[model samples]
Structures are given as structure tokens and as C-alpha cells.
Target: MKTRIKFSKEGNLRFVGHLDMMRYFQKANRRAELPVAYSEGFHPHQIMSFAAPLGMGLEGKAEYFDLRITEEGAATLHSAEAAERLNREMAEGIRILSFLRLPDDSPNCMSIVHAADYEILFRAVAPEDKIAGQFVDGSAYRSLTGDEERSLRAAVDELLQRKEIPVQKTGKKGNLRELDLRPMIHALRCEDNRLRCTVAQGSEANLKPELLLSALFSLDTARPFAAMPRRVVRTELYDSAGKTLESYGTIF
Candidate 1:
């Protein structure tokens, strides 16, 4: 049988790389005494896979991974109880959110990821000086004059109306190429000193929230948001039909 585990990474742990994260979970599974399956062969490895690994330095509100349970008593483990046992093994910055059974015919979590929602809060809020931190820019960061708020709002509006928003990407061999990010952005709104955005996510095409903000900042040079600190939190991930990964299975 297979199980999907939902968890969140925050605080200092956000710096943990994907490979390290896998090792951490493997150890956690053993510490929790779960019936985790192992690959067959000369060197056995845990049968675990993550769904759309988050980028380093960013926080995630909802994240998921799947595992194979092969022990004889695995079927008897209650979903909630499994989450509880796993929670005990998590470090301070990571938390187990849910455990659910995936249908036999269900697709891999990583493959079906189509879109993502994010909330950004910049560390700096003052109109004149930079307050560095993590987040998306909006009027909500700090007390902004009516004019400053309007300026930020106007920047976002102008960006969305453009035919293409281009950014440079480095190829595997270190070649730089310009990529357009406009179409990948499904939606964006700046209000309450925060920026809420939805963008294409997954293997096909991805648009980073930072690129969107940088584009907006470039449009209006009055406020230097590009140099300010950035803080981003991915709120949730969705499938092509607009459903969260959690919706595909039931949580106990």
C-alpha cells in the first residue's frame, strides 16, 4: 500500500537542501517505526518520493510526499496515529500535517502538479529606506502613504497588461537565455501590504515569485523593491482541474 504524507518546512530548516531533506525523512521514518518499504537489490533504499520539492529559503504551508508501506502490520496503522508518530521525529522547523491512503490507480504526486499559490511579505516597509526580509510586495508590508500604495498597485497592473515579462535563465552548461514569464502567471494581486499570486508550477513550466516582483519593481523605479529582502510562503499546490493534492485523498 502507499501513503501520502503532508508536511511543512519553515524557520531555519528552510535552508535544508532537497537531498538532505530526503535523508532526514528516511531517518524520521525509522525513528517513528513506520512500515516503510525498501527498494530491492544489492543496496536497499527507502521507497519515498516527494511532490514538487520547494526551493531552498522559501517556506511551504502545504507540501506532500508518498511512501510505500511493506511491513506485515502496515495495514493496521491508523492514519492519524501514523502522523502523530512521525510528528515526534520531526525537527523544530518541519511539521507533519496529514497522512492519507492513495488509490492504486492514482498518479504520482509530483507528476500532477499544475499550479501553486503564494503569499509574499517583504521584510522592508518604509517608503524611503529598505527593510530587508522575506515576502511579496504589497501595501501591507508597512505603513505606506496613499500615494505609495497607489504606486505599488499601479506597478502590478501595468505588469499584467504587458505581452511578455522576460527574465534570464542559465542553462545547465552556464549559457544564459531569456525566458518569458507572463503567461505562467495565472493571477496576482497586491493588497494589505502583501502580494498574492498564482503561477504555473511543476515539470512543464515554472515562474518564480521573485521574478514577478522584480519585473514590477523595474516598471516603477521610484521604489526600489528589487534590493529589499524577500520572504515567500507557498500556500498550496493544485492540479490541472484546480484541486489541491490533499483533495485527491481523505485525511483521518
Candidate 2:
């Protein structure tokens, strides 16, 4: 039997890398004494897989992982009980949100995740500055102002009017290429001090919020978000058609 776990990453745990989180879960599972299955080999490993791995320094309220367990164990281990047990074992910054038993034929969580919603909170630059029109470069590090708020709003409006927003992407071999982000951005909204965006996620055409912000600000695409101070939180995940994705238990 396979079980899907929904969890949240918060506080200092946002700084933990994907690999570290994997290892942490391994230890937590062991500590919780869940009857998890292990692969057959000299170097046995747990049969577990995570959905989308959240980027470092980015928090998430809806993260998922699937683990296989013995049928006998699954019968006895209720989902709610399992969640409670895991919560007790989880570290300070991580919390278990839900535990669900998936059907035998259900697809892997990672493959189903086509998009993700993110809330980006940061201090924008004052729009009154001469560089506000440019909207990029070193001017973003400054504080926000009423005039700048209107300027940023206008920028967002202009960005949405265009059919294609081209940005540069660097390949592994250091080659730079142009990529259009307009198609990937499913939705976007600029509010008082936050930018809410939903963009293409998963293996195909992933668009990071920082990348979108960089493009929106007309910054240099080759590391435009390097020094930006911001807090990113993933609020939801969705399918390719822009529908909210539900775990195994919520499928009904």
C-alpha cells in the first residue's frame, strides 16, 4: 500500500535544501516507527518519492511525498493517526498536514503537478526615482512609495498586455538563449506589497517566481534576481488545465 503525505515547510526550514529534507523525512519516518517498505538490495532504501521539490529559501503550504508500506501495516495504520505520529517526530519548521492512502493505480504526485501558485512578498523600490521607468538594475533594492506603487502597477499592466515576454536563460554549458514567459504565466496580480502568480511548474517549462519578477522588472535575465530580498511561499499546486490538484483522499 502506498500513502501520500501532505506537509508544510515554514520558518527556518525554508532554508533546508531538497536533499536535506529527504534525509530528514527518512529519519523522521524511522523515529515515528511507520511500517515503510524498503527496496531489495545490499543497500536497501525506503520506497518513497516526493512531489515537486521546493526551492531553497522558498516556503510551501502544500508539499507532498508518497511512501509505500506493507498491506498489513496499512490496514492497521490509520491516516489521521499516521499524521499525528509524524507530526510528533517532525522538526521545528516542518509539519504534517495530511496523510492519504492512494489507489493502487494512481499516478505519481510529481508527474501530476503541472502548475504552482506562489505569493512573493518583498519591498519594492520607490517609483519616484529616476530609475523607476527602467524598473530594473540596482534600483530595486530601495524602499517602496505611493508613486512607486502606481509605477509598479502600470508595469504589471503593460506586461500583461504583451503576448510574449521574452527572457534569457543560461544553459548548463554557459550558453544564453531566449525563452518566452508569457505562455507559462497562467495568472498574475500585483497587490499592495505582494505579487501573486501562478506559472508552469513540474518538469516541463518551470518558471520560478524570481524569474518572473526579474522579467517584470526588465532586469538582466542572466541572474537578475541574485541580490533581491524577498519571501516566497507556494500556496497551491494544479494540473495542466489550471485546476486545483487533489491528493488521493480528496479525489472523491
Candidate 3:
């Protein structure tokens, strides 16, 4: 039988990378003595997969993983009990939220994942309040006075309309490639000192939340605020049709 686990990453633990988290989970599973299945052949390994890998230094309230279990007795263990047991043994920043049984025919987490919602917070070095007030107050600032802001808005709008927004591909023999960011960006808006964005996921078209922020910063000459922390929080996960497949509360 297959099981889906939902969890949260927060606090200082946000610095943990995906691969390290995987290894941690494998160790926890072993410690918990969960009857997780092993792969066939000589190099047999845990049958586990993550829905989406969160970037380093970002936090997530909703993260998911799927695992196969072998023993029917183990399958009968209550998911809630397993979650509680895991949390007791887990480190401070990582918490297992919930676990549920999944249909054997359900699609893999990687393939089914399509979108992610994130909240980004940062302090602007420029006179953000003054500039934002002008835009919100409906008093048109002189074109020359707010040229940087105007230019930034124009760039964002143009990028939104484009069929593809090319981003530099890393870790490849060819360092540069055009990635279709249009399909990835479902929504992007700024509010309350934060930029909220929902973007497509998976191999098809992936957008790094940091890249969006970088693009905005690149448009203006003002330096970002010193000693102002930038934080990212992933709020939710969705499927291709924009349906919530699993939530943080229900993720183990």
C-alpha cells in the first residue's frame, strides 16, 4: 500500500536542503521501524518520493512525500499515530503534520504537482512607502520622478504577456537556455510588504521565487535594505488543474 505524508519546514531548519532532508527522513523511518518497502535488486532502497523540493533558506507549511509499505500489519498502523511518533523523534524545525493512505493508482507526487503558492517578505532600500503611496493615491507622479518604478512595472507587465521568459539554466554544459516562464506564472502581486506569487511546478516549467525578486531588484538602481531579512514561505501546493491535492494540515 502507498501512504502520503505531509509536513512543515520552519524556523532555522529552513536552511536544510532537499537531499539532506531526504536522508533525515530515511533515518527517521528506520528509527520508527515503519515497514516501508525497499526497491528490488542489489541496490534496494526506500520507495519514497517528494512532491516538490523547497529551496534552501525558504520555509514551507505544506510539503508532501509518498512512500510504499510492505507489511499489511504496518499498513494498518494509524497514520496519526505514526505522525505523532515521528514528530517526537524529529528535530525542532521539522515537524510531521499528518499522513494518509493513498490509492495505489494515484499519480506520483512529482508528476501530479503543478503549482505552488509563496509569500516573500523584504525591506526596500528605496522610499517604498512614498512610491507606493503615489501609485495607490491615484496622484500621478511626474514621469521623470518615478521613472524607475514606471520602468519596473512595464517590465513586469511585458514579461507577463510574453510566451516565454528566458532564465539562465544552471548546472548544464550549455549555461544559457530559454525557459517558458509564462506557463509557470499563474499569479504575481505585491501587497503588505510582501510579494505573493503562485507558479507552475515540475519539469515542464519551473520558476524560482528568488528569481522573481531578483528581477524586481535588478530593475531599480536603489540597493536593498541593509540588515533587512528576506524570507519566503510556501503556503500551499496544487495540481495541474489548480486543485489542492494535499494541504499542510494533512501532510505527514
Task: List per-prediction Cα lDDT, in the order shown.
Answer: 0.81, 0.78, 0.70
Model 2 alpha-carbon drift over 4 Å, by segment: 123-145, 219-228, 250-252
Runs in model 3 with CA error above 4 Å? 123-167, 221-228, 247-252
lDDT of 2 at 209: 84
Residue 34 CA error for candidate 3 (Å)?
1.5
The sequence of per-residue lDDT tens digits that candidate 2 reaches over residues 1-252 is: 877888989777888999999999999999999999999989999999988989988889888888898777877888778999999998776889888878888787888889999986653544553232211122232334566456667777778889999999898899999999999988887775567888999998799887888888773322333455667889888767665545455411
Q: Would you estimate the TM-scores of all the predictions?
A: 0.89, 0.84, 0.77
lDDT of 1 at 51: 86
Best lDDT among the predictions, by candidate number:
1
Task: Please give, for residues 1-252, the per-residue lDDT of candidate 1 as tens digits.
Answer: 777888988777778888899999999999999988899999999888888878888889898998888757465888989999999999887899999888878888999999999987766445574433333223233443467667777878888888988888888999999999898999998876667899999999888777777677787632565675557889899999999998887653
Q: After superposition, how far is residue 246 of candidate 2 from its true place, in Å?
A: 3.5
Q: Regarding lDDT, does 1 or 3 come out ahead?
A: 1
TM-score of 2: 0.84
